[model samples]
Target chain A: MRTILFLLQKEFIQIFRNKTMLPIIFIMPLVQMLVLVFAANLEMKNIKMKLVDFDNTATSQEIVSKFKASPFYNIIGYSYSVEEAQNSLIDNSADLVMVIPPNLEQDILNGQSPKVQLLIDAINGMTAGLINSYSSMIMLDVNKDIAIELMKFSANQQLKQISIKQRFWYNSGLNYKHYMVPGIIVILVTIIGMFLTALNIVSEKEFGTIEQINVTPIRKYQFILGKLIPFLLVGLFDFALGLFIGKLLFGVPIRGSLFLLFSFAFLYLVLVLGIGLLLSIISDTQQQVMFLTFFITLVFVLMSGLFTPIETMPLWAQRVNIINPFAYFMKVNRMILLKGSGFFDLIREFLYIGIYGIISIVVAIRLYRKTS
Target chain B: MKALEVSHIYKTYNDITALKDVSFNVAEGELFGLIGPDGAGKTSLIRIIITLLLADSGEIHLLGKDVVKEYKYLRSRIGYMPGRFSLYSDLTVLENLNFFATVFGTSIEANYNLIKNIYSQIEMFKDRKAGDLSGGMKQKLGLSCALIHKPEVLFLDEPTTGVDAVSRKEFWEMLQELKQKGITIIVSTPYMDEAEMCDRVALLQKGEIMSIDTPQNIINEFSEELIEIKTPDLYEVKEKLRLEFGKNSAFMFGQSIHFSTSSKSKSKELLNEFFEENNFNIESVNIIEPNIEDCFIKLMTKDS
Candidate 1:
C-alpha cells in the first residue's frame, strides 16, 4: 500500500508539473462540450415552402395560412403557375411545394374529396420525411374543419370521432441538448481517462525511466494498482468537472441521486483506465498508443448510441455494443439524468460494467511483463 | 557460494545472434569488468544476468538462487544501472532518489551511508529537474538511484559511455570506494582504460570472449614486440607496412603507427632501410610496452 502511495505521488507530481498538460486536461473537455452540444443538432426547422394555388377559394387560402403560421415552414412565394413552383424548387428557393386543385372549395361544397399535391426534395431523406409528415398534418386539419362544417347542418347526423393526444414523457419539449449533454459528457470523461493513461506509461518507456522501475522489488499488481489509481482519480475529477459545467452552462439536470451517478462513474473509469494501461503495456511508443487509442475511441463513440438511438441500429451492431463499456455508460448517463432512475434501474448495466472492469484489469496485468 | 554465475548463456534477437554460448562468473565482493566495443553482446549479457531478459539457453545463479525461477527474491538484493541514463528526468533529484528508495521498502536515510559520497555532489541542486542536469550529474544520479537499495550486487552497464574524461575518472574513483565496502560490482564499458580499474577483465568481441584475466596479465601475455613509428606521410607508410608485413601487423594509434612482429630487430632494420630508400622523413622509431588496448587489438586479430 505504501508503495502504491509513492507511485501515485510521483505520477501526480509529473502530471501537475507538466505545463502543457494542464490546459489539455482541465479546459479542453469543457470547450469541446460547449461547441459540440450546440453544433450537433438533429431538429429540422425553417423549411422553405412554395405555394401553387389554382383554386381562388377560401379553402386554398386557409391551407396556405395554416402552413405559414407554423414555425416549421417559411412561405417563400405564391406561384401563379405550376411551372413557377417547379422553377422555385429547381432554383433552390424552396424545399417544399404545395398545389391545390382549382375546384378545392367546389369539391368540398359538392361533398366530394379534392386532391392536394405536396412535392418535397428527397435528397436528404430525414429532412424530406419530416417535411412530408408536417404537410400531411396541416392538410388533415383542413379536411377535418371542412367536414365538421358540413355535418353541422345535417339533421340525420350520427357521427363519431376519436382524437388522440401525445404527451412526451421525461423530456416534454424533446430538447436535443438535454439528451446530448449527458452523452457528450460521457465521451469527454472517456477521452481524458483513456488517452492520458495510455500515453503515461509509454512516455516513461520512451524516457527510459521504466527500466529503473522494472528492476525494483515491486510486485506487478502493486505497480498496476499504483498506475491505475492516479489516473482513475484524475478521470473521476474530470467527470465531475464536466457535470458541473453541464449544469451551469447547459442547464443539464441530474434527476437521480448524485451518489449513484458518481459511483457508477468511478467503476466505468476503472474499466476505461484499465484498457489504457493494457494499451500502454502492449505498445512500444507514444505515437502507437495515440493512434490505437484514437481508432478505438472513434469506433466506440460512434456505436455507443451517443448521437443516434441504439434501438434503431441493426441487430448485429447492437450485439457488438454489448461489449462496449462506453455504451453502458451512455445508457446509464441518460437513465440517471433524463429518466430519474435509481441504482436498481441500472443494476444490470452496473454488473456488466463491473465484470468488464475486472476482466480488463486481469488481462492488463497478464500482459504487463516486468521482464522482457 | 559464488556471488554470480552464468553457464553457457545464449541469446538471439530475430536472425542476429547477440550472445553465442557465453559463460563467466564473479566471486563475492570482486569487481569484474566486461570490456568490449559496441554491439559486442555486453549489454545483452548484462540484461540476461539481471533477469530483465530471457536467454535462449543458459543457467544463471545469483546470490545462490536461480535468476529465472527466483527473480523476485533476487530483485531486492541486486541493483542495476542500465546502459542508458534511466532516471526520471521530469522529477527532481531528491524526488527520484526518494522514490527509488521507497519502492525498495526503505528510506533515503537508511542507505544514505552507501550513496553519500556520490549523492552529495548533486545534493545542492537536488531541487533541479534531472533532465536539466549535465551528463556527469545524470550519471551520478543514476548510480545513486541504483545503489539506494543497498544491494549486495551492483550491475552497471556502460555507466561512463557519454561522460567527460574528468567525470569518468571521478566515477572510477567512486567505484573503488564502493569496492572497499565489500559490494560485488560487475561493470561493462567500451573504453579499455576502465578495464585496468577492475580486478579482472573479459575482452569481448563479436559475441565471443577472446580473453579473460587481469588487465596487466593480459597486457604482459601480448607476445609480439610493439613498435611505434611516425613519419611525415603516416598514411603512405602504413600502406607500405601493410604490404610488407600482413595487414594485421600494423594499425594507427593516436598520431603514431604501431607495428607488431615477432622478429623485432630484423623488422626495425628493414623498416629503417625502406624509409631511407623511399625518401620518407622519419620522426621516431621506438618500441613501447603494450597497453590494454594494444592487447585487445592483438587478441582480436589473432582470434579472427
Candidate 2:
C-alpha cells in the first residue's frame, strides 16, 4: 500500500538517523555470528572425563582405552575413591566418571558380567545425556570383546541380531554452523524487526508524539504500515547482510531459491511487524515494550527449535511452533541454505506465514487504530 | 453546520467515569475550548472527537461524518495535538512534517502554505532532531505537523501545559490566526487565563460539564460577594473568617484569604471584625471579580 511505503520510508530514516539504535542493530548481528559460530557445537571434541578404576584389570584398562580413543570423550584425570570422584564432579573438574569395582576381572572369568557404574552430571541435561549414550555404546563394544573370547573357548553362546537403519537425510554431517547459522538468522531477523519496531513506536507514545499522529487525517492502516515498513526493510537488509556473512565466513550454502527466501521472509516480516505494532499499541511506555519484547522473542526463539530438533521437542511446544513464524522460517532457512530446498519444498510454510501475516495485520490495525 | 458534535457521551475506564452524559458542539469555523483542570476528561473527550478513542455511549459527528462508524473519514478531517509533545524524537522537524504530510496522500509542498506561519520559525533547524528542540520549538513543530494535512477540524489537547509563559502567549496568538483561516479549533487547557482566549469555553469537573458559555458570561454568573482579605497573620485570620463569615467557601488564593458570604450586606463589617477577633493586622481588603479558576473551585466544591 502507499501508506505502507511511507511508513517503510520513515522507519528506514529512523533506523539510519537514530544514533543509539543503529549500531545495536547493524553491528550486533555480525558480532553474534562470529561469537556463536565458534561457541556452538555438538561434537564435544574435548570432554574431560575422570577414571576411578578400583579393579586395575586388563579389561578395565581396555574400557578406559576405548573411551579415550573416541573423539567425543577424553580421560583427563584418575580418582581412587568415590569421594574423590564426587569431588571432581562437583567441582566440574570432570564431566563423567567411570567407577570399576574390585575383582571385576575374576567376575568376568566366572561367567558373571561385572557391574560398572557411570556417574554423569546431568545438570546440563543435553551434554550429560549425549555423554551417557556414548558411554553406553562403548561398554557394548567391551562386552562384545569379553563375549567373543568366551564364545571361542566354550562354543556355546550365539551372536545377537541388531538392526538400525540410521540415515541422516538433509545434513548428514550435522555441521554445527550448517544447522546453527540458518536458525540464528531467523531469530536475528525476528529480534531486529519485532523489538526494534516496538521500541521505536513506544518511545514516540512515551514522548506524546503518538497523539500528534493520532489526530492526523492519516488512516489507521497507514499508521500501522508506517510503523511496520521501516523495520521490515531493516529486517530484510539485516537478513541479506547476515546471509552474506554466513556465506563468506562460515561457508554456508544457500541451496534454497533466493526468490523463496525473500518471499517467505517478506511474509514473516509482515507477521512480525503486525505483532510489533500490536505490542506498541498495548504498551504504555517504552520500558514495558522492551521487557515484553524480550520475553516474547525468548519464547519464540526457544520454541523455534533453534537448539534442539523440532522432532525432539514436546508435542505441546511442537504444536505451538505452528503459530510461531520463526519456527517455519528456521526450517525454511535450513532447507534453503543447507538443504537447497526449492519453492515447492517450502510452499506450505509460505502459505501459513502469509495467512499469519494477514490475520495479525488485520487484528493489529483494528485494535491499534482506535488509539489514534 | 456543526463542525463537531457529541451527544450524551459516557466514557468510563472501569470505576472511573471519565465522561458522563457529556454533550457539546462546536459550530463551523469556531474556536471552542474545553477548560478544566487535570483529570477533567479533557483528553479523553478530545481523543474521542479525533477518532483516536471511542465513547462508551455517545454519538459523535465530525464534519457531518459519524466518528465511530465513519472513523476513517473522521480521521482525515481532524487534526489533533495531544497534551504531551508526541513527535518522532529521532526525526528532524522537517522529517516529521514531511512524514505526516505524506501519510495524508499529500506532500509537504502541497500544504506548506497552510503551515508557513508556524513552520518558518523552526524551518531553519529542519535538520536538527526534534528531541533536541526547545519546548517552544517542539510546540511549534507539533502544530506544524498537525496543520500540514490542513484538516477541517483541529483538536489541541493541552498543547501548552509545560511551555514557558512567552511560548504559551505566542501559541495562543497562532491559534487566533488559525481560527481566522476557518479551521474549527477545539482547544483544552488547565490554565484559567487561556479560558478567555477561546470564543467560548465549557468548564468541566469530574467528567461532567459544569458550565458552558463565553468566558465573560460564566464569570458574570458569579452571584456571590467575593473579597480578598489579607492580614499579617493570614492563617489565623482565615480560621476566624471561616468561623464567622466563611459559611460560603472561604479559601486561600495566594497570600490573601478569598471567602464568600451569603450577601454583600453581611460582609461590610465582618471582614474587619474577623481580623480583629483573630488579633491580626489588615494590610489589604478589596472586592474582586471571580476568574475561571475560582469558578472551577466553586464547581468542584458543588460536585463534592
Candidate 3:
C-alpha cells in the first residue's frame, strides 16, 4: 500500500511538472463545452427556400405567404419559371422550392385538392429530409385554415373536432448539448486517462528502468498498481471537470442521481486503467504502446454508439459492440443522465464492466510476473 | 550458509545457450566478482540470482532460500544496482530514494546510515530532478536507492562501466566500507583492474567458466613470457611473427604488442638481431609479469 502511494505521488508530480499538460487538463474541457454547445447543434433550422409561381394568382401568393411566415423557411428568391428555379437549385441558393401551377385556385374551389409541386433538394440527405417535412407541415396548416373558413360557411357537425396535443418526454426542448457534451466527456476521459499511463511505463522500460526495478524488492503487483491508480484519479478528476462543464456551460441537466453517475464513471475508469496496465506490461516500447492503444481506442469509440444509436447497427456489429466497454459506458451515461435511470437500470452493464476490471487487473498482474 | 548457490544452471533463449551447466557458490560475507567481456553470460547469471529470470534447469539459492520459490524473501535481503541508470528520472533524488525505501517496507531514516556515506556527496541536489544530474550522481543515487532497505547481499552489475575515473575510485572505496560492515557483495565487471579488488574472481567466456580463483592464482596460471615490442614498422613485425609462428606467437596490446611464448629466450635474440638489421632503435624490451588481461587471453587461447 505504501509503495503504491509513493508511486502514485511520483506519477502525479510528474504529470503536474509538464507545464503544457496543466492547461490541457483544466481548460480544454471548458473550451470544448462552449464551442460544442453552440456549434455542435444537430437541430434543423433557418432553411433557405426558392419559389416558382406559374399560377401568378392570389391563391398562389397566399400559399407562398404560409411558407414564408413560418419560421422554418427564409425566402431567398423567387423564379418566374421552372428553368430559373432549376438554376437556383444548381447554384445551391436554396434548400427547398415551392411550385404553384396556373390552375391551383380552380382545382381547390371545385372540391378537389390542388396537386401543387413541392421540390426538395436531398443533397444533404438528412437535412434535406427535415426541410422537406417542415415545408409540408406549413402546407398542412394552410389546408386547415382553408377548411376552417369553409366550415363556417356550411355547418357540418361531424367536422367539429378537438386538437391532439403532444409533450416531449425527458428533454422537452430536445437540447443537443445535453446529449453530446456528456458523450464527449466520456471519450476524453478514456483517451487521456488510460493510454498516457501505459505509454509512460513502456517508455521507462524502453529507456531501461524496468530492468533496474526488477532487482529491487518492489512486488510486481505493487509496481503495476502504482502506475495505474494515479492515472485512474486523473481520469476521475477529468470526469468531474467534464461534468462541471456540462452543467455550467451547456446547462445539461443531470436528472439522475449524481452519485450513481459518479459510481459508474469510477468503475468504468478502473476498467480502462486496467487495460492500460495490461498494455504497459505487454509492450516493451512507447511507440508500440501508443500504436496499439491508438488502434484499440479507435475501434472502441467507433462502435461505442455515442454519435449513432446502437439500435441502428447491423446484428454482427451489435455483437462486436457488446464486447466494447466504451459502448457499455456510453449507454450508462445516457441512461443515467438523460433518462434518470436508477441502479437497477444499469445493473447488468455495471456488472459486466466490474467483471472486466477484475479480469484486466488479474491478467495484467499475471503478465507482469511472467514478462518481468 | 552460503550467500548464493547454483547447480547445472542452463539457460537458452530460442537457440543460443546463455548458460550451460553453470555452477558456483559464494560463501557468506565474500565479495565475489564475475569478470568477463561483454556477452559472457554474467548478466544472465545475475538476473537469475535476483529472480528477474528463471533458469531452465537449475536450483539457485540466495542466503539459503530458493531463488525462484522464495523470491519475495530473497528480494528483501538483496540490493541490486544494475549496469544502466534506472532511477526515476522525473523524480528528484529524495523522491527516488524514499520511494525505493518505501517499496521494501522501510524508511530512509531507518537505513540512513547505510547510504549516508554515498548520499552525502549528492545531497546538495536533493531537490534537483534525477534526469538532470551528472552520471556520477546518478550512480550514487541508484546505489543509495538500492541500499535504502539495508539488504544483506549487494549485487552490482558493471556499476562503473561509464563512470569517470575519480567516481569509480570513490565507488570502490564505498564498497570497501560496505564490506567492512560484513555485507556480502557480488559485482560483475569487464575491467581487469577491478578483478584484483575482489576476494575472488571468475573469468567467464561464452557462458562457460574459464578460471575461478583469486586474482593472483589466475595470473599464476599464465604459461608464457609476455614481451611488449615496439618496432619502426610494428605492422611488419606482427605480420612477420604471425607468418613465422602462426597464431600463438603474437597478440596486440595497445600501440605496442605482446608476444606470448614459452621459448622467449630463443626468440628474444632473433628479435634483437632483426631490430639491429632493420635499423630500428631498441629503446626497451623486457619480459613482463602477466596481468588479468594476459591471463584471460592465455586461458582463452590455451583452451581453443
Score candidate 1 by DockQ: 0.81
Scored against the true structure, residue B159 in model 3 reaches a CA lDDT of 95
Misplaced by over 4 Å in model 3 are: A46-67, A70-129, A135-164, B232-240, B262-264, B274-283, B301-304
Task: Considering only chain B, report the TM-score of each candidate against the true chain B.
Answer: 0.97, 0.94, 0.94
Residue A313 lDDT in candidate 2: 87
Question: What is candidate 3's lDDT per residue for B1-304, written digit by digit as tens?
Answer: 8898888899999999998888888988888999888999999989888998988998988999998888878877899888988888888999888878877889999989988899999999999999999999999998898899898999999999998889988888999999998899999998888888888998878998878899888888876677888755677777777676667677777777677666645667766776677666546666778787788777777767
Q: What is the lDDT of residue B169 in candidate 3?
A: 88
lDDT of each: 0.90, 0.83, 0.83
| Every candidate's TM-score, chain A alone | 0.91, 0.90, 0.88
Backbone clashes, each candidate: 0, 8, 0
Q: Which digits, one per residue and each the tens of the lDDT, describe model 3 over residues A67-156?
A: 878887789988878878877778888777778887887777778887778777788776876887787788878788778766765785
**CA displacement after TM-score superposition, residue B182 of candidate 1 (Å):** 1.4
Q: For model 1, how many clashes?
A: 0
How far is B275's C-alpha from truth in model 3 (Å)?
A: 4.6
Give the DockQ ranking, best first. 1, 2, 3
- What C-alpha lDDT, on a 0 to 100 scale, does residue A81 get in candidate 1? 90
Point out the worst 10-residue segment of candidate 2 chain A by lDDT.
A209-218
